[model samples]
Each structure stands twice: as C-alpha cells, then as structure tokens.
Target chain A: MNDNPFSLWVYLSQSPLLWLTVTLVTYAATDAVSLKTRRHPLANPVLHSLWIIGLFLLLTNTSYTTYFAGAQFVHFLLGPATVALAVPLYENRTRVAAAVLPMLVALAVGSLTAIVSVVLLARAFGLPREIILSLAPKSVTAGVAMGVSESLHADPSLTAVSVILTGIMGAIIVTPLMNFAGITDFRGRGFAAGIAAHGIGTARAFQVDEVAGVFAGIAMSLNALVTSLLVPLAVTYLLR
Target chain B: MLEQIARVLLWLSLGEIAAKSGLWPLPAPVTGLILLYAELAIRGRLPDDLGILADRLLQFLGMLFVPAGVGVIAYLDVFKTEATPILAAVIGGTAITLFVTMVVVNRLGRTIAISREPGSERVEGAARDVNA
Candidate 1:
C-alpha cells in the first residue's frame, strides 16, 4: 500500500535526518518571519524555531531521539564552534582581560543567584524538591544546564526551560539595563548578555552590534567554563 | 583540506584528553580550546580553510541551541512542580547576576585601561591622573 518514494519521506518523518531537516526549515521560516517584520524580541529565532520543531514532533508522533540523530550534525559542530569563537576572543583579548575577574565573579554570583532564587522560590511555593533542584543552575548553556540538572536529579526539561527563559530575559533586558546604568560600551553590554544569556543571548548580542557579538561570544565561552564547574559544586555542597 | 582536518582532529583529541585527565577545572571543550590555541602557537598560524570551516560553523551556532531548547517542552512537568521557584530563579537570578557583573566589570575596566565606555569624561579624567 505504501509507495517507496512517497512513504519514504513519510516514514523518514521520524528519522533524525528528516527531523533535522524539519528543524532547520522551521528555523529558517521563523527567522524569515522575524526579519521581514520588525525583528521582534519575542519572535527570537531560537524561541520560534523551537516552537515549530516542537509542533512538528508532536504532530508527527516523533520522539526527540529520532530528531537528535540528524540534529547531531549541529551538536557535533558545537565543540568546533566554541574553539572557532576563540579567534574573536583572542582578537579582543585586551578587552577580555580588562574584566576577567569581574566576569568570573559575575558567573559565580550569577550561578548562585540563579540556583538559590529558584530553590527558595519553589520552597516558598511548596513545589517539589526535584523540580526546584532542576530549576537551579539553569542560567548556564544547555550542555551545562542539562549536565547540572542530571547531576542534581532534577528534570533536564525544567532546567532547559529555566536556561532558555533566563537567556531570552537577559537578551531583552541587558541593553536597557546597561543604558540605565550608563554602561553602553559594546563590549560590556555584549559580555553581560553572553554571560547571562548563554547561546541565545550571544545571538541577540550580535544583533546589537558586531562588537556585541564578538564580546558575547567571549563571554559565553567563559560563562560555560565557570558554570560547568560551579553549578555542580553548588548542588553538592549548598543546595543538597 | 587534509591538514585542516588533521589539525581539527588534533584539537578534538587534545580536548578529550584534557577532560579525561581531571587537571584544570575547564570542560573538555575548554581544554580542547586551550589545546587548539597551543597548536596554533606551535604551528604559528591557522590555515585559511580551517578558519573558513570555523566561520561557517559559527554562523549556525545559534540554531544549534534549538534541540536543547526543546528540552523545555520535555520538562513541562518541571513547570508545574516548581512553578514559582523556577520563575523566581530565572528572573531574579538573571537581573541580579547581570547587575553585579556589570558593576564589577565596569569598576575593573576603570582600574585596567581598557575602559568600554571610552567617552566618559570621569573615567578619562581618572585614567589621565593615573597615567600622570
């Protein structure tokens, strides 16, 4: 009953290759929509891309496992991508050193602030401990966030949400807050976004200026380094 | 192309070893990065093709985050279980972290001479006094 070619794309619907295709096309469409219009903050490429991908998976009854296979192309690049960003960080070394300690301090304090606020709030609201723990340390990059969540015995999904929301919030607010604080330097603003927002924030920073993108990339690398270390310790020592 | 591939592979292996070694606190990726830099130092220059590969990779880096972003959908149970706390953690934590980071970095910028805010007369005045 099933035609080989016709059913192929349909059966492949659940294949990672198919899902990855859907994922990329979904993002491209959303990005086009955002660009054609006013580049609305909420219409963020990551956020909208996720939405379309999610809907496709839901409609097609495909699991994330099927998607990850194809999507690994993107994942595989993440390491190289981080190293590549180093080029810019090196180019901007003078500026990077200017606030190295500050960035470290921000990451530490930021990690703590992120974890504590969630746990305490969850406690206040009488939420389950697993969920609270999951929410902790979610402000970091997804890899770190997922790692932290797994280590903490929290749901990776919850932590993932916390991380993305934290990033989107940071991308949206960092500029205005910097304006208010009278700190409008592209490097400073970009760095702040990168540290707080992680990958998504890095993307948003690029939109503001090339300098922002450059510094944000630097900040992101540094933030990933710090949170990967600190989030675990915080859970083992303090949160537990 | 082969040389570029070899170097990239070299960098990846070095990073993996670093992560497995448990020496510095950085992740395998960071360790990988440090190794890449060291390789560059020894080689004295990264070839153009390698740069091109890296550049193309970086362009789609943002989209790479989407799969992880989908993790949010899976964590829907997390929302219900730790609703208030999760919100507080993300919102409060972000604002505070951004604030404190900016303060420390700004102050540090003043101390160092790489001021991000180049036109600020106050910071300029302070730097001049220090230089004088």
Candidate 2:
C-alpha cells in the first residue's frame, strides 16, 4: 500500500474534495468550541479556523492555490449569501426605515471615519503610500475592498488580508467593547460592527441578536458603497 | 429549497451583469443584495424557504471567508516587513472606528427618537429591551 500509485494520500492530494472537507471540518470543529464556550469573543471561529487551517497547510507544504481549488466552493457561496442579506433587511424593513435617519447619519460619519482613521494612522506610523492605499478600504467586505484597493493602485491581496484581519479583530472585540460601553441597542451595535468589520462582524452580531444581525447586514452593504467612494477621495486629499 | 437557491442565484446573476456594465462601481454581491431587497419590497412578503435559507447560510457567514483569508499566508512577507505600522493601523484604526461609530450612533439614537412621532417612543424602548 505504501508503494501503490493510488495511495490514499496521493489521491486525496490531487482532488478538490480533500481541502474542501478540511475546510468544513475545521470550521465545524472551531464553531463547536465557540458554541460550548457560550460564544465567547475570544473563541472566534474565523480566527481559529484561519490559524488551524493555515498551520495545516504549512505543515503539509500545500500551496494556497491547491487548497483554494477545493475551498472555492465555500468561497463562491459568499455571493449568494450576500444576496440573501435582503431577507433580513426585508423582514425588518419597518424598523430599518424607522431608523433611516440615524442610519444615514451614522453611515456617513462612520464610513468617513473608517477611511480617514486608517489612512491617518497608517501614515502616522510611516507606512508606504501603496500600503496606506490598501489599508484605506480594509473595513469593507473582501470583494469590495479588493476592488477599491485595485482602483487606488494598491495591492488587492494585501487589502484582502487586512480586510480579514480587520474582520477578525472587529468580531472579537465588538461584543466586550459594546457591552462595556453600556450599549444596549442592537441596531447601533450591529451597525457599528458592519461598518468597522464587514461580514465577519455581521456574523458575530447575528450570533448575539437577530435585530443586530439585520442591522449589521444593512450597514455592511451600505458601507461598501460609501467606503468605495470615500477611499479614493481620502487617498487623494490626504495623500496630497 | 431549490427555488430559494434559484431566486438568490438569479438576483446574483443580474447583479453580475449590472456590475460588469460599469454603470456602478458596486460589487456584484452588493448589487445582488439591493436587487433582492427591491424584489422582496415589491412582493411585500418574504418566502419562508428563503428566510430559512438566509438564516442558515448567514449563520456561517464567517466560515465562507476562511479560504480567501488563509490566502493571506502567501503575503505574510508584507506583514513581516512592516508589522508595526500595519498592525497599528489595522488594530488601532478599526478600534477607533468602532468606538466612534458606536458612540455617535447611540447618542444620535436619542435625538432621532425625539424627532419622531410620540408613538415612536416605543421604538426606543424596544431597542433598549433588545440586549438589556
């Protein structure tokens, strides 16, 4: 069996099924820990999944391309999942509409704050222009953030990485931060998460409360639009 | 279930076309979200299956980004070269953004409530009761 051409390791390595299974299993395992811990912020499944899978790949010497070949199926679902945001939005359309004024005010101020703060902080820390450009859209979802990064002539992959890091950070901290601040409003909490952390933050909000999840979904979508426009302008005016 | 999946895919496809048209800079998924929302609004009701589907899939929304996130390993060099500024900007900037946005929105919530009808006080009460 060790010398056989059709050995299990050889076959598994060649097919997309292996990495796909690994991705699902890793997420399920980490998520179980998250649940058992009563959904503690420190038990963030995404953060856990990243390191676990990342280490597994490093150990096996598997290239990311090979891994993504199997994992793309899960990644593709992000599109449909995004579309499905409409359901929660529609379900709470009355509340969303009722809070439109605050949402609008929060959206503009929050969106600008997200961009300006990142750029200024990065510049203050002496990051290069290209890196600063990439960091500008780090708060938006990966897809939109990558697009904005490319448009700004920065590294899209770096933007994707920062976007995920931002998401993980946002997911982990939002709960304790909000609770400590005595924020009892799900709408505000979720909206802030969506703006600062994107989908992962929205996921965290959903785990906490349905109302927060819905509002987070709205904020994530809206911020994608607002951030795309603001990033370029901020890049220009601030960079100059 | 199949119908719900098709409904989502249909909107997503339309969103792709809209995005490719370059009339808007929005991502296809964001466009898809808007299109689906408009559809639900026009229909004036959500399909039960779709709601169930959204809830199920979205519950694992964090998982979906793991693959691309793992791709970050390839660019670990960037982080290694500029760990301080990068970490500071991503961590510090996100924290500030979250704190500012949350505080501002929460404070504005009161002003917004006062601006509404007398009956709208219940909205404020409901928000307070949500995680209280």
Candidate 3:
C-alpha cells in the first residue's frame, strides 16, 4: 500500500491544495445541509465538516501535518476573523455600554466556573497534571488556549483538541439548555455560549441572532483575556 | 475590497506587534479587536469599506475554525486513553458554565431591564433587517 506509485490518494495527499479544498468544500456542503435543515443543532456544519475531514484523513492515512500544510491558509484567517468581531461589537456598542456592569460580572464568574469546573472534574477523574493544565483554558479560543497551555508547560495540541470539544459541546447544547432554564435573553444566551465555548460558540450565537452574536464576541474576547491571566495562576495555586 | 482588507490586516499586525512586545498579556487578535473597537469609538462609525470587508469575513466566521478544529485528528491517541476524563470535563464543565452564566446574566439582565427597557426588542427588529 505504501509503495503504490499510481495511487490517486498518494498524489492528492502530496498536493497541498487537497486539504484546503476539502475543508472549504466540505464546510460549504455541510453549511448548506445545516441551512436546509433550518440550522438544527445536530446539523451543525462545523461538527459535520470536522467528522468528514477527520474520516477523510483516516481513510487516506494522511498525516495531520500534511492536511494542515494547505489548511493553514484557512487557519491563518482566524486571527483576522477574530479581529473582525469588533465590527459587531462596535455596532452594538450602546447595548454593550448599558450592560457593561453585568457583562463584567458575568465574565468574571463565567471564566472562573469554566476553569474551576474542568480542573476539579479532571482531578476527580485522576487525569494527569498536564492534562488538567491543558483543560484550564479549554473554553478560550484555540490559539489563545494553545498559548496558555504552552505557557503552563502543558501540551498545546491537547489544549487545541480540548478547546474544540468544549466549543462543540457548548454550541450543541447551550441554547437548548438555556431555553430549558428559562433563559431567552439573547445577550445572556450569547454571553454564556462565548464563555463556555469561545469562538465556535460565538459563531453559533451569530447564527441565532445578531445581538447574541455581538455579545458572544464580546464575551469571547473578554474570556480570552481573563483566562490567559487567570488559568496559570489558578493552576499553580489550586492544582499545586 | 483589497484596500479594506489591507487596513484590517494592518490593525491585526499592529495587534500582533503589541502582543509580541509583551505590553499586554492578551492574544494578538483580541488586542486587534480592542484596537478596532477603539478606532470605531473615536471615529464614530466604521469606515464603509472596512465595515463591508469585516462583515463579509464575520458572516462566515465558523469556516475559519474548521482547519484548527480538524486538528483533533492529531490527538486521537490522547482521546483514546483519556476519553473519559476529557469528555467528562469538557461536556460537564461546559454545561455547568453555560447554565451558570446564563442564569447569572439573565438575572442581572432582568435587574437592568427594569430600568433600561427591553433593548433587544428594537435590536431584534434591526437584526432581522441585517440578517435578511
């Protein structure tokens, strides 16, 4: 199998564009399906695209490094995309200003809960110290979470995986869970999603409503800042 | 469009420089967002060109995360070994955070709403137009 010179898989795997195109096309198709299904939580395009891409890599025996070579182009946009969150935040400035106090309080408590719960639970399960440290910033965006993990001498790749799973879990269940809890306020819903899930959750909030999206953006940014500062200190103090 | 993107990239670069300089313990993108927000605040509105580009990028923001999210494949071994703790922490922790944050924010929002009026009603109407 490794010596198959004529194999299409080998050729495609060699091409950097393969993973890039696969990512974009799979996301577009999954997004369409999500729309057709009226954006049902289970029809989440990110989840679908992730599974599809993961399976593609597995079936082809393509290394993640190879896939990421092309996919980095898309990954590069995350920085700018995160900065672009300011547009919505600025657009909703008045509401943000009015709710600043509550947002700050929520950010404080939410950030704490996200960090503490993961650490406590991970410890209770007797996970390794590095794993617990990686889980500390799981609710932050991948880039920031990775940075935090690295600074804590934890595994960045593990942190990235934890962050994605945290986001997916929050995106899939937060809204319904909030609704059951009688929380219909877009601001609250969006804030909670951002605090719990970070970027993916903020994206999900955007899909639900603009106001929610705006607050989600704000929460995501604030959570990143708060988590980066607090996670290291908390890990040293509590875990040690 | 090119110019607008360049301007946004400039801000992002500035943010990266600032973060790298170690002046603030924040992510470059976040610092960039804060800089952008400050610019908007001082300018009173987003420049038409930049707003268009930013809106376009943000409209499909989820797509930007697909690449990184797919990195999960790299950690399949970790997942296989630590699946229970990882899943328990992520799922249970996120649920708890979501529930607690929503409850706290909802309560606080109600307190503010008593005096502020339901701004979301008007915002929802405007949001419909933009979303449409």
The runs of at least 3 residues in candidate 3 whose Cα sits more than 4 Å from the true structure, single-residue gaps closed, are A1-12, B122-132
Worst 10 residues of 2 chain A by lDDT: A1-10
Per-residue error (Å), model 2, residue A32: 0.8
Q: For each model in turn, which proportion of the native inter-chain contacts is also found?
A: 0.47, 0.73, 0.70
The best candidate in terms of TM-score: 2
TM-score of each: 0.81, 0.94, 0.93
- Residue clash pairs of candidate 3: none
- Error at A42, model 2, angstroms: 0.7
Question: What CAPRI-style quality would you assign to candidate 1?
Answer: acceptable
Error of 3 at B6 (Å): 0.7
Residues A1-240 of candidate 3 have per-residue lDDT tens digits of 557765867777778778889998999999899888777788888998998999998887888889999899999999998888888888877788888888999999999999999999999999989889988999999888898899889998888888999988888997678657766678888999999999899888988888888989999999998998999888888897
Mark the 10 consecutive residues where model 3 chain A has the least summed lDDT: A1-10
* Residue A134 lDDT, candidate 1, scale 0-100: 75
Residue A174 lDDT (model 3): 74
**Model 2 lDDT on a 0 to 1 scale:** 0.88
lDDT of every model, 2 decimals: 0.68, 0.88, 0.85
Output the better candidate (2/3) by DockQ.
2
| Full candidate order by TM-score, most accurate first | 2, 3, 1
Q: List the residue pairs that clash in candidate 1.
A: A122-B85, B15-B32
